[model samples]
Structures are given as C-alpha cells and as structure tokens.
Target: MLIRSFDVLPAIDILDGRAVRLSGGKREAPTLDGGDPLRLAGRYAAEGARRLHLVDLDGAFSGVPRPELVRDVAAAAGIPVQVGGGYRTLEAIEAALAAGAQRVMVGTAALSATFVRRAVERFGDALVVAVDVRDGRVAVDGWTHTSELGPGELARRCAELGVVRLLVTSAARDGSLAGPDLPLLREVLPAGLPVLAAGGIASLADLRAVRDAGCEGAIVGSALLAGRFTLAEALATATG
Candidate 1:
C-alpha cells in the first residue's frame, strides 16, 4: 500500500473568545482551559504546525460565529487555518474565509443536498463537510442532534456533491483521550473521499493509527493541550 502524506493539524477550540476543549462535544461539559487563543496559535505555529484547526465552540452552540477571532488567530498563527462552527450559509462561510480561513467546515448545512451542491459550486476546494458521528449516526447542530444518516452515507453524499474533504469526528471520543475511533475512519474511508480524523487522539501511536487508516490528516485537541506530547512530536510521527 502506498502511504499517503499526512497532516497533523493542532486544534484550537474557542469558546467565548478563549481557547477551550469540551469533553465529548458537550457544551456544558467541564472544559480544559487553553489560555489565550492567539498565543496558542502562535505557539503552535512556532512549534512547526503546518496548519491550525480552529473551532468556534460558542458559535457552534449559539449559531453566531466569531469571524474576528478567526481573523486574529489566522494572523497570529501565520499559517493556513481551517475554521468551523455556525457556518450554515454562504454568507457565514464567506465571513470566515474573508476573515482568513483557508478552508471552512460546515456541519448542519451539509445535510441538505442543495446546500452542499451550492457550497461546493461557490467555494470549491475551500469547503469541507464535517461528518461528526455519535453512535454510528451523523450528529449535527453542533452535535446536539443526531440524524438518520450514517457516516458512510454522508461521506458518499459529500463526495458526490463535490465536497473536497470530510472532517470525521467521533463525538463520543472527543476530548476523552481514550484513543481515536479507527472503526469510524474505516467506515468512512471506503467512500473514497479525503478524510481528516478528529476526537480522542491521545498519543503518537494514535496518530500513527489514524494515518494507517488512510486519513489525510488528524485534528488533535485535548492530548496536545494536556501536555501529552509536543506538536513537533506529532508532526514527526505524521510525516514519517
């Protein structure tokens, strides 16, 4: 098998303008505080992060995005950023891109084929559909609602709609550090679409597993924040 080049995107999840990680995608769950979003972005960039995964946790729950914060982090990180949360419309998506995001991830909106087709037509490769899974079903509305669509079904839909990539997140494993849901990756990878795995990435070994599962990249959160490993170590493991 040909080993594909993999990317390790350090995640900076923002809540109320501060960096935080919500356990298991729960809005009210206890958060792991990661001080000063811009500072963290800069630090990650300095530590050799190729790209940053920025999430507006506040916007995700409230349906109000903070594009200015995205702008600030992107400017501070001085690297490519893929931002998500509350981007349900073309205008909202445009705001994030205008703010400095190289790519914008849409969740609930992606459930609509019309929206997916239009988003792909408008943004092309800049649009990424977030296929957040919970109990084998696609979760949406900031992961508060579970849909009937499965991960594989959603992946196939996005691929058919011309979505450039899918960000597959295991809501149950997110921030738990139990380990990645490789089985979930396997379910979606068969769609023959580019995928970026998120949630429960605990160690370098977990990163390797994600790579071996054929993910285009991995979005790591809690582990990196808890000092489980350095960003340099993650990048090295992903590249090798």
Candidate 2:
C-alpha cells in the first residue's frame, strides 16, 4: 500500500460569529477568540495551510449551521475548507456545499448507518464523518452527550458505509495541548481508513508522533492559536 503523507489542518471554531477555542469540549472553559473568521482563514492560508478545518460551534450546539458565515469564510480562505457541526440532513449538507465548503462533515447523523449511506451516495467523497471520543465512548451533541457506541465500532461502521476518511478527535483532549491520545488513535486505525487525529497536539513533536503512528492528517487548534508553534514549523513536521 502506498503511504499518504501527513497533512496539518488548522482549525477555526466559530461561536456567535467569532472564532473561539473550547477546552476539553467544555463550552464554559476559557475561550480564546481568534478574531474575524475570514481574516484568520486568510492568515492561515497565507502561512501555507492548503486545507482548513472549520467548526460551527453555534450550529453544533443548536443543530443549525451558519451557511452565510461558512460561505464568507470559504470564499475568503482561497483554499479548500471542510466544514462540520450540525450538518444532520441532506438539505443542510447541500447548503454547506453550496456555501463553498469543499467537504461537509457530519457528526451526530453519521452514527446512523442509513444517514451515512445516503450521505455518501449523494456526496460521494465530498462527505467526511467525524467520530469524537470522550473517555473511550463516542460523543455527540457537541460532545455534551455520550453514545453507547465505542470508537472502534463506530469506525468499522463508517467504513462499511463507504466513508473514505474519518476525522477522529479526543473530546477530552481538545484544546488541552497536552498531547494526542495515541492509544485511542490506534484503536480507530485498524479499519485501515485514512484517519485525521485532532486534540491535544501541543507541539511539532506531537505532530511527528501522530504521523509516525500512520495518521493521514492532524488537526492543530489551541497549539497554533496559543503561539506554541508557527504553521510553517507544524507543516514541516507533518511533511517530514
């Protein structure tokens, strides 16, 4: 099998029309605003980010994506952007794509086989499934609700439904900048699908560790926002 080089995705989480970061998936946790979404997206692109990861915090909690904001960011980003949060129905998915998102990500809805199958059939590879983990259990509803399914089981089901890539995130580690939960990543990688690891990536060494573990990509949020490392340094680690 040909190995895929790692990609470092910079995340932009929007809440009430501002970019913010949530610690340990807790909305009440210390939130750091990253300023205007379009400006931040443009800055990341200028720094050499080829792809961007965008999360609609309002949509995730309310179950409705801000299509206009998404459209604005995608248009200004000048790079491929994958959008996630509160995309549950076909119409919602279509709206995101029409808004200029290169790929639409579904979280809660992806737990259902029927939904995933229908989404894949309609969107093909343009759809990505996000499997958020908290304490070894799958989380939904913006990580406020824990489902009965485990990460491995969810990964297997997503693959069976024709999901070409899985965005696996550790809800407990998100924005913590401690380090990635490699064991959790190992569990989901058995399906042999392209997996992107998110949460607790504190430094370039953390990026190296994730790449060495065989992840196709890593999403760095608080680390970059915190100035722990520059995008250029992180991208070099990913490509190295």
lDDT of 1 by residue, 1-240 (tens): 244699999999988777999998998885699999999999999999989999998889987888898899999999999999888999999999999999999999999999999999999999999999999999998999999999999999988888879999999999999999999999998888889999999999999999988899999989999999999999999888
Candidate 2 lDDT tens digits, 1-240? 134688999999988778889998787885577989889999999999999999998899989887887799988899999999999999999999999999988899988899999999999988989999997899999889999999999999998889988999999889888899999999999987899899999988899998988899999889988999999999888776
> In candidate 2, which residue pairs get closer than 3 Å at backbone N, Cα or C atoms, i.e. clash?
none
TM-score of each: 0.98, 0.98
lDDT of each model, Cα atoms only?
Answer: 0.92, 0.90
What's model 2's TM-score? 0.98
Give Cα distance to truth, residue 117, candidate 1, Å.
Answer: 0.2
Find the candidate with the highest lDDT and give its number: 1
Instruction: Give the C-alpha miss distance for residue 232 in model 1, angstroms.
Output: 0.5
Clashes of each: 0, 0
Stretches off by above 4 angstroms in model 1 are 1-3
